[model samples]
Target: MNIADVDTPAVLIDLDRVEANLKRTQDYADAHGVRLRPHIKTHKLPRFAKRQIELGAIGITVQKLGEAEVMADAGIADIFLPYNILGASKLARLQALNERVTIRVTADSAETVAGLSEAFAGAEKPLEVLVECDTGMGRCGVQSPQAAVELAKVIAGSPGLSFAGLMTYPAAGKYAEAARWLAEGKRLLEEAGLPAKIISNGGTPDLWHAHEAEVATEHRPGTYIYMDRYQVEKGVATLDDCALTVIATVVSRPTETRAVIDAGSKALTSDTLGLTGFGHVLGYPGAVITSLSEEHGTIDLSASDKKPKIGEKLRIVPNHCCVVSNLFDVVNLTQGEAVVETVPVAARGRVD
Candidate 1:
């Protein structure tokens, strides 16, 4: 399909850039001797996950049980979930999923561990559980090393759970401190005779410094596959590195300095990620995406030396590419200007 033939407010994934992003990150993991178990929350495509494994990923990581089921159906054998899963409904599904693939999960509390233990108690194999540690991100992890080891002991002694290791998603730019915290947790685990098997640390904001977290045996980076404006602002990716972009048509030129595009918050997303604008206008370096409603994105073309006229198309690099993937059902894969293939987002709403 030609680029012009495709409808406006569509997502475009550059095939060339995708390959470069995959190989570059994989090579870094290889050189650093750390396993690259990429998180699939970014692309959520089975094909891309398979490509990641082909490039040398240890396995794939999913943030939700529903996502794991989708990938498992696609023949992805191993998956690591880095969220604290609970509730009987989700646990029942987790049991069914565990029967089909190798799975590891993280827990920050005893209640979560109990649920996992009960779900896999009579299974043929024990479920491996990692104690989620909050080195500094302050999201969903145990606060201190002592707390981590205590949870590890609880998991190890559980009916159907084995303490695998420690996992954390630290605050960006504070990996060194997070490492120190994780290292202490590792030391305590060792002293307690429970050797950690996987020290997992991840975040795309500090992709290049992933190796510096020496305690982490595996890294889970999701956004590197389709770099976004947030990654660019953080200096983790350049605009050229961005593989995903929103193609929107200029609908109305309300004024000489203002224009409206078909893509809006539903396409470009409202996640500013601390940036000034919603997204970066690809060609109009000076253009600012001032505001976005559900179906309209207001563009301030005054700053731009050149502006698009009515009926012209604009490409926007969203603030967060992962969220954008969930909004679109299909993403057009293109090489240059020709749309080579378009695929459904297999796990689009598998956010259970």
Candidate 2:
């Protein structure tokens, strides 16, 4: 089917570009002597995740247990869930998933370790847990290297938990600081007779600098598969590297400088990522996605005299591709202007 024949507000994935991205990232990891555990949160497709493993990815990373379950069912043996899994119901499901595949998770506190130990205690295989350190992201991680070592010790002592090593999501361009934090934590663990086995650090923005963190043995990058406007703006990727775009049709031409498309926040997402607009129109060099409501995207044509007329079609590169992938139920895999296949987003809305 031709891309033009597809319905409006549809997500288009350039298959060729996707393959290129996969190869480039894998090659970089291989050359650096670091393991590549591509995060599946961006694409959330079993086909892509499987392809990543086939292309030398040591494993795949999922933020939630629901996503991990989907990947495991698809024959992905090695899955790493970096988020802390809490609650009895969630832990029960996590235990069930662990039985099906090799799983590793992260912990930042003694309470989290206690819960994990209780959930997996007496199991045939102990669960692997990593100490999550907050180098600078200031998110859900231990604030200091000492805290990290303490957590690691707790995991090592827990009956059902094994201290796998350290993990961190450092702020952009802070690779050195993150490495120092992980190194210190590792040193302390070794001094206490507990040697860290795996040190994982990840962020798409600092992916190229992964080797700078000498303590890290693996890197997890989610958005590198299908970069968006934010990555482009941050110099992490070029426009030619982006593999996904939203195809929208002009539905209204309200004024000379104003036009509307069928895609809205529901389709394109509302995350601007501090950008001035929502997305970048592909062919329209100066067009700006001024605003996005529930079902309509307003475009500003003030920068250029040429404006989109009613019924015209346009492709938009969203500011954030990960959220946009979750917003859609299916994505069209395209080669040039032809749609080769439609893939279901199997892990969408699996927040639990």
Candidate 3:
């Protein structure tokens, strides 16, 4: 089918742009001599994850056990669960997943590590554990480098747990600071006779700056595969680098300057991050999405000489592509203007 034949508010991925983004990121990591474990949370499709691995990614990073399970079932051998795995039910799932593949999980608490060790004791394989450090995000991680080292030591001494590395998701422009923090933690761990080989840090905004940090052995960048408005707003990627967009039809021209499309928060998500609006209109670079409802995207194009009329189609790049990917069940893989194939968002909404 042609591009115009597709339904409205459909997810479209430009394959040429995606290949370029993957090669660029993988080449950057190769030149820097660091492992690239591109996070699969951004594009939860197994085909994309396998493509990333084929393009020199050491493995894939997942945010939850459910996502990891999906990837593992799809034959992805090396997987990293960056979130702290808790609860008996989740631990049992993790244990089973560990038996299937090389699974690594993150934990910053002694209690979590102890619990995992007990749950996975003699489970046919040792679970690699990384101490999640709070470099500055103020999220779920240890407060300081020394604190991270303490947690690492606990996991190292545990029966079924092996200290794999130190992991953190620092805010943008905080790479230098996070690098120092991880270096300090590695020093302390070494001084205490504990393992601290891998220092994994991830965030789309800091992917380019990953090599600047001397201690980061592996970088996990998910959105680099499909750049979006959030990455563009943060100066991480350019508009041409963005691979995904929602194709919508201009259903109404309410005013000369404002037009409404059939794409809304349900299609593009309501994630702005204090930015302009839902997304940016392609070709009409000056046009901005001012407002959105469940099925309407209000675009402000008062100054444009080429205003879109009713029934016209417009491609909108979402503010956050990851969330947009989760909202859709399938994405039309396109090359230039031709619709190639529709790939299912296999792991969409697998957030458990």
lDDT of all the models against the reference?
0.92, 0.91, 0.88
Per-residue accuracy of model 2 over 1-352 as CA lDDT, tens digit each: 9999999999999999899998998898889887889999999999999999999999999998889989988899999999888899999988998898999999988888999999999888899999888999889899988888878888988998999998999886677988998899989889988888989897788888887788898999989999999999998899999999999999999889999999999999999888999999988879999999989999999996678879988999999999999999999999998999999999987897
Q: For residue 13, give model 1's deviation from the true position in Å.
A: 0.4
Q: What TM-score fits each model? A: 0.99, 0.98, 0.97
State which candidate has the highest TM-score: 1
- Which of candidates 1 and 3 is the stronger one according to TM-score? 1
How does model 2 score by TM-score?
0.98
In terms of lDDT, which candidate is strongest?
A: 1
Lowest summed lDDT across 10 adjacent residues in model 1 is found at: 91-100
Clashing pairs in 2: none
CA shift of 66, model 2, Å: 0.8
